[model samples]
Target chain A: MKKVRIGAGSGYAGDRIEPAIELLEKGNIDYLVFEALAERTIARENLDKLKDSSKGFNPLLEERMMRSLPIAKKKGIPIITNMGAANPESAGELICKIGEKLGLNNLKIAVIIGDDVMETINGYNTNLLETDEPLHTIEDKIESANAYLGADIIAKALTLGPDVVITGRVGDPSLFLAPMMHALNWSYDDYDKIGQGSVIGHLMECAGQITGGYFADPGYKDVPNLERLGFPICEVYEDGKAFITKVEASGGTVTTATCKEQMLYEIHDPSEYITPDCVVDFTNVTFKEVAKDKVEVIGGRAKPRTSTYKVSIGYRNGFIGEGQMSYGGPGAVSRAKLAGDIVKKRLSLRNVRTNHLQVDYIGIASLHQEASDWLENEPYEVRLRVAGITPQYDDAVKIGQEVETLLTNGPYGGAGDFKSVREIIAVLSILLPRDMVKTDIVIKELN
Target chain B: MKLREIAHCRAGDKGNTSNISVIPYDENHYEYLKQNLTIETVKAAFKDIVQGDIVRYDLPNIHAFNFVLYDALGGGVTTTLSMDIHGKSLSSIMCNINLPDIRD
Candidate 1:
């Protein structure tokens, strides 16, 4: 009959903390998790750490900890987060400092590390998961390499009875799964229970996503009160059966539609969802709308866990330069097309070396590219966007420069001309043997 | 009729690949989707953006079909020159697919 009410605090790093505050105040949850890290966030954090030794954790870590720490401590609810980004040790210290400022004494904070595998990565001749290319090809450009740690180590951190557990580059779902494993005392080798926990973690990891934040489509898939969207909560039982719901007074509805959408979101294979803990089979997963706002999730099968951990390698890929100019009036489409051509020709004349270039009429064929076609009635206005991927930073700037030239030189009635260039830190993945990487937890308690 | 009329979809990306899940508004339309939502139909619709293979996974228990498009995003979110790097808007495109009308 024992159950844990887990509340998803923040979905991503920059997610609003108000909903999380609501969860702590009204939800009466036992565990609160903040799934803050994204695929490229840690890499960007590593770059920050390179500049400043003390930097590299989530930018809003102080703000989040300052706001949530007192409430979570008062409620006796353990908090978990991947806000540590590239540096959990420093993040833990900062949290301790914030807790002291808040007058919170005896606040136990656990910082989990060892996801970074930059040193060990070079030793293995692993091939990139996406492409057949070996890791050696872009070794020089590597910025940060962190493996996706699973729930076992996180559960180990929980055994120490910490009020808050902060980690770097752990699997998004593992944050939620760890709490379940610790609370329910589930064995690591129990793939079935691990699979169920993984499903629950995956579903709750995105917070408001399952509660209609991204499910709104004007008339087709209408979600009400989205403006005040409430994050999701899972009332998970010891049996691994959980009810996905939200706070009653809050906005957003937790329905079967939203649950189904989130179940397969970002998942490649339905039956074979590979998490660090185990391989989940979501195909058999069932959602029953037992109530208006509560959907009962059941039946998530699984196989054994994989021996290797997926490491996300971030490296300097190139630079992307983009330029945009808007055109209006009766013949805007034609004018924009002409403007696009001018930018292309100008780039060629400037000898701008680019690996990939695209001249798109924004309103027409930008998103779908060749897949999109013109409408029957031509658009009265259009924005021409010229973007290119170049090896050198100077060449990237030239792409946008050419587009900027079209404001007066190439196209008529051009307005809102803009140009920007940014360095691309691309991410690639490789599988490293799990044994090669070791995770260590450092706990800091406010006395 | 359009797929949007009877079904809804959500698109998600991993590396260079994208997965779009199509779920029917009504459970009755599940069979209709399985029939008309063929690989060829999706391939033709996404011919421009998707450069790799398209595979569909069916989940009758949930009444949903997941379409996995490989090498979809120009190169992926970080490296791609395309404006919609994450391919988040690809769901809208999937909803725009044309479907045959069903008899009452």
Candidate 2:
């Protein structure tokens, strides 16, 4: 098999598509993968906006992805992304429309469904619920429930000849691994090879995370032109092992340290790094700096996946209000801390117990000094962020108004105001046993 | 009288700011857990186990409360696999507690 070139895009959430397009254009990579939503990225109002626009949550991803589909069609590179939150079929239809507009009506669009079990959980069994606690029957009341799908659906879609494959809530690594499986025709049971491909996808999923973007290496601090950092790319071999490197002349460097830093991100346990394809063993893995711009990742082991699929659930909850203020200058840290105390005391007196409160003096010399805290001598910003849940809307408003008042009478040498505090909806994530649910893929050839 | 609390119980070493997590065994008690397990309560609960000042965070989405227990475990999470070392399974234990009903 020829070297499978995979390109990953940059940015956390609501990022532009130009960087991803640039990488695909320059590298001529076979697959282009992008991630749009994560647990931390979901916003209530944003979700409502998507519903209003006939799109679901995180529609920006689909909008940007639609803009890139034309280019992807012209270049003959298949595009896969996780922009399908709450409504995968609708998002897929939008992509098809974009394809039609671009005169690429022959676009085969695949809608990966069955992951949206928010409304129909009863159709699936819950024998996977191992705990004794009576699981809430949320099938009827669930606002959103998306299954974290694996690469199998994506590979199946690709086989049906889709120009673009949009998924609801597939695992981040699965987005990259699906392309490899399609290209190599690897079976889901192929543990070793599948594990190898999974490791490669995991490394590149977080965009620039593997390329000094979040590295703690002092030498990497002076990396020039970070505003245009290049996203990471993987060169996979038939054996499943791959080397991670960025565009050769890209701004950031891909060193062993950078790769190691990225590896540690979100990995709670090295031995039990679970994924849809396999349980990757990061323990015996070895990283070798083969070249200045490349690092070889080897010795990743895979085990059987647990018979459960992690489900992200969001529900309607009580209202929550949050406010922030900034304190600058020499005594910024002390004043900010003091301000936070005042708010707490006032809230306590009013019997308003907040669900959460935070006071951070961002510019203290002791904090982030090693990361070149250049703002220490010039000016500093201390922010206080607070939130709470209340059934009464009046209570929520009162909390918001009180926190904003801390700026003038509570703390000196600082400027603060009450910002809008939105309602806090219940968003819960549960891992449903895989045996309980089924996935079906429907591919449509749009012409 | 400032009551020191177990604002949050995390399985990580002491540091300025670190990721603190708790898993509720039951979903129905999630709202109750959120109400009782305030940052102050979390701090007051684990004051003895932690060595530093407590700065609590609200993680509404995860249905868990987080706290930045500063200078607590030495160098924070980097010190050790705090999860393994703590060994208390506070998440399950907290779930067992009978929380007072706070619903309207």
Candidate 3:
């Protein structure tokens, strides 16, 4: 039976590259996939790209490529990655440059583009998926618009047989799915197999997340040696039945429990798990531990692919100001509460208006506080945080200033007062017809 | 007893909405969760942060429930100023719901 092993290197843009190096050195893997694009990361990259023409790709692209490319090249392992945040073309060029600097010759690179749809989005009168607000309302503030591309674009890039495939704004799972489809010679119409590949992609997309990296909770759900967490490698069969495991002599475990947790990580609906490839049915999925550290995944059904592509649109959404001060020792909770109260009162008195204001005593009750919160014993230490949002940057700054004023007016032991204001770009989604988004691949081989 | 004692969860956010998947630690408690983990209760548990309706999707094969919180996360990941921006920490709160003893 023909089977292939693919290693999931970096989960997100800033994910550590050391584990990826371990995967290359120890894990005899055929392909390495690094999913580095996040929705907000790309938006921020677009803003930077606007400021400087060549500044849009993942900021750590050079460091990541420099660190991992040579090792992967020496191992003869092809890499598939989306480190191409907003600029895959430039990212490709940079990768070529890195390989040359490493004395690597005859290395082929593929840069997939056209996921960005900022220029051609004017044709549709689309409304925001979350708020029903018209896209026209925020037209002037629009930063970048990118449609989540699928595995097909990646499959096309793979046909050229490049050592590395880089892309921008593609679906997270597509990074893994493309390699499976390309190597397995699966067609676009193979819904059931595509669904299985999608599930495999999801499990492997987050790298360590499925292998007990993010699932540990101390005594409740204990994971050992998380400090030396190992990334995941998948053994995918030609039949679309795959098992997940970690590199040899690495930390983290892959069990049925871990697989189940990652299966529905960000999924909204199991029956209609929509992706550019197909609507995957995660309801019937099953995981079985046929061997130690290897759990076989099966039974992912799929429906027809959607006709439209979901475009992630970023727009300037105003500014946020936050200030925090700590109080310790006896009566710390009360002192923090008093500081919060004072800041709220001062902000109101000073007419420092904001769209929203959140006054939290961090240690006492910031994450979980409601009308039903029962007053417990006073905390030993507490941090008072006052965060506010406003249309004007100056008003946003006032929110933090109000909290700073509490240094003298607040109760005793107020220390570590700090404040910061930042411009925010809220993300919104709109579906555009598939025809509106086009994909093109450019390949470069080291000479 | 607390729901955390019987179940474990993972959460993710998109835009202003958040989705939390709650699965019982033991498969025997699947039916119990399906019956007890209602939308009303989940909404009440996250009343402070979740502003919109909570829609629950039942997955019997996996013995899990995916609760989608609409209009939550305070303008989603990019715009939210919360320390835990992705709402990755919110699912543990979902696990803290008070559940009736399974013996009943």
| Best candidate according to DockQ | 1
Instruction: List runs of model 1 lying over 4 Å from the truth.
Output: none
CAPRI-style docking class of model 2 based on DockQ: incorrect
Best by TM-score: 1
Fraction of native contacts (fnat) of each candidate: 0.92, 0.00, 0.59
Q: After superposition, which runs of candidate 3 have C-alpha atoms over 4 Å from their true positions? A: A371-375
For candidate 3, the TM-score is: 0.96
lDDT of 3 by residue, A1-447 (tens): 668899999888889888899999998899999888887888899998999887799888899789888889887899998888888888898899899999998899999999999989874688888779888998888998999999999988888889999998988888888888888888889998899999899888889999888899877888878888999999988889898998866888888878888888888878998888899899898888888788989888899899999999988988999999999999888788888888888888888878888887787567655533546777678899999888899988998787787888778778999999999987888999999888898987788
- In model 3 chain A, which range of ten residues has the least summed lDDT? A366-375
Look at candidate 1 and give me any clashing residue pairs. A106-A446
Off by over 4 Å in 2: A40-53, A122-133, A137-141, A216-221, A327-342, A348-353, A356-386, A389-391, A406-418, B1-104
lDDT of prediction 2? 0.62
Clashes of 2: 19
What are the per-residue Cα lDDT tens digits for candidate 2 across A219-333? 3134544666778888887777788887767767786555654554445455567887789766556677899878998877788877878775555555666566777767776
Residue A81 in model 2: lDDT: 76
Collision pairs in model 3: none
Per-residue lDDT of model 1, residues A135-156, tens digit only: 8999999999999999988999
